[model samples]
Target: MTVATFDTAVIGGGLVGCWTALFLARRGARVAILEKGSVGAQSSGTNFGNLRLQGRFPGQYPLSLRSQAIWEQLQDFVGSACEYERTGHLYCAFDEGEAEKLEGYAKVSESYGLSIERLGREDLKHRYPWLADKVTAATFSARDATANPRLVTPAVARAARDAGASVFENIRVSEVRKSGSGFELRADPDLRIHCANVVNAAGAWAVEIAEQFGETAPLFAAGPPQFVTEPFPYFMSPSVQTIDGSVIVRQTRRGNLILAGYPRTAADPASQRVPVPPQKTLAAMKRLAELAPVLRSCSVIRVWSGTEGYLPDMVPVIGASETTPGLWHAFGFCGHGFQIGPGVGLCLSEMILDGGTETPLEPFGIGRFRSGVAVSEKFRREFDERKTA
Candidate 1:
């Protein structure tokens, strides 16, 4: 066979990789995507589809904002239906302390241009009569919404293909090495792909790809358990979250109630399979019952799990590699990449094509992990200080 050379090679065909390839190909660069499976077959298609802005880490606020804006105009770019729904989002609190924290967060969020409204106990009960009586307060971000996870990545891949990008499905990259002028990717059997630059958006298997270039990050597999109930009356509209990060509940357009909030199971990134624990499902169902008593009559019809990468700092690693030139990394999204997938792609495309991005990529560099201070330790210390504050 002949050599396949491209200006850029993307190592994943998920939503992020597809968007990155779309932007690069649109910019007149030769781009090809290598996917171990069909596009959005794994985490991208299996997530709860929350395009939320509330309760996110402060560092992710800007990216979430940008991604939300892109999501609002998704069809304009992808030229396909993503099943996007602007159902708003609500974070409920069960106690006064939790409510106070939410009130404080709402105030802080306003400075960032996020108009989150805090509802007191009476106000929340009056607006959402279905909520559990234990709910003391809630905060609502009207711009937050949900979409069809199953449709997003495929739509993006189709858009990228229309923009002159090639997507190779079920072709796994066994190994990658720096060649004389670029990188050579060794694939199944006799396939070899040469590219000037590679973007490691390999989803759950991102760490392995980054390691080939001498870049190391602390990423672990976290599989959030999810289940869907039989179609019922569409009572709930907005996606709902708890202030303590326990249970997330949402009702789809088809009236199927989808939820996730239990102990995560170990995930195998290589296989991209995560089995939901039976006990965890029961526990999550119990919690859901407490949050919304009306769910007691709803029977869960199906349960599933998706493999997601979780970094120690709970942040993503984006931008150029520190050790290897002509290499870039954009992975380790820590279970929240779904909301910011498009923004990450746009920023990375800008960095690769324009030498810099409007979005700040310094905070997500791999150098942060190289520092003597471990992210887990820093996070623990910060949490302790916050408790005192």
Candidate 2:
């Protein structure tokens, strides 16, 4: 087959990849996307749709806020329904340490001009009767939102295609190498992609593929095996589980409750692994009951799981690689990529096209780590010190 070329080749067609492609294409840059499966068929579509801006590390706080702005007006540009909803998020504090952390975050978030209201348990109970007593404190981010990922991402790809960007679905990249003044991508089952820059937004598989180009930055899987429940009324609230928690039960605009959460079991190493069993379901159900007592009546009609990568510092690496000069990273979201994907994708595209991002993408660079190794020890030590305070 003839080698397909573009000014830029985006390696993954998930939301991040599609957003990156469309954003760049809109700027008149030729863009192409290669997907290992149908567009937005993997983690981008599988996970819960939380356009949240709560409880994120202060460093990522600003990026998420910017993404929320894009999500607010995305449908206007897409010319179709993306199903953005004002399903406010209530980030709770189950312990004093958590409360302190929440308090600290709330103070700084205001400086970003985000309207996050902190509430005591009593105040929470008065406003919403759904919460359990286990919640000691909570912060409400009214700016937060949720969207049907199933709709938003595909629309992005469609828009990109409409704007002259080409997308290849189910064409897996087998190998990558620097070629001429650009790069060459070998796709399995057939096809080769040669372009000036290659983007790795392969969702769960990003780390594995990035390493083939010599990026060994210790990005491991994070998020639990998740599943969704049948449709229900507007309840459950668009909330998140913290203190390393999961069980992201949110009511869809279609009235179905999306049941999903993190589990302790790890996925197998061979491929994008996710195993769901009876025991796992039962344990998650129990946790769900504590968070929302009404969930006792809601039976778990289905279950699913997906793998997501985690950098040791709990941040993503974006921009030109130290070893692979033309390569740029857009992975390791630590399960929170969906909310900030638009901002990230836009920043990456800018970095590729303009040589540097106007937005603050420095905290997320690979250089933050110690020569390709993670700063997990520093992250843990700081986390512990915060707990004692």
Span of 10 residues, lowest total lDDT, candidate 2 = 380-389
Would you estimate the TM-scores of all the predictions?
A: 0.94, 0.89
Model 2: colliding residue pairs: 226-304, 227-259, 227-304, 228-259, 229-259, 231-256, 232-255, 232-256, 247-261
Error of 2 at 344 (Å): 1.3
Give the runs in model 2 whose Cα sits over 4 Å from its true position. 236-244, 269-271, 372-389
Candidate lDDT (C-alpha), each: 0.84, 0.75
Output the number of the lDDT-best candidate. 1
Per-residue alpha-carbon lDDT of candidate 1 for residues 264-349, written as tens digits (9 for 90 to 100)? 66677766788887777788788888999988878889998788877767778888999887798888886788999999999889
Model 2 lDDT tens row, 205-324: 777776786665676653455666766677555655544454566777666677665543454445665667678788778887888787777777777655566666767766677777
Please name the candidate that would achieve the greatest TM-score relative to the true structure: 1
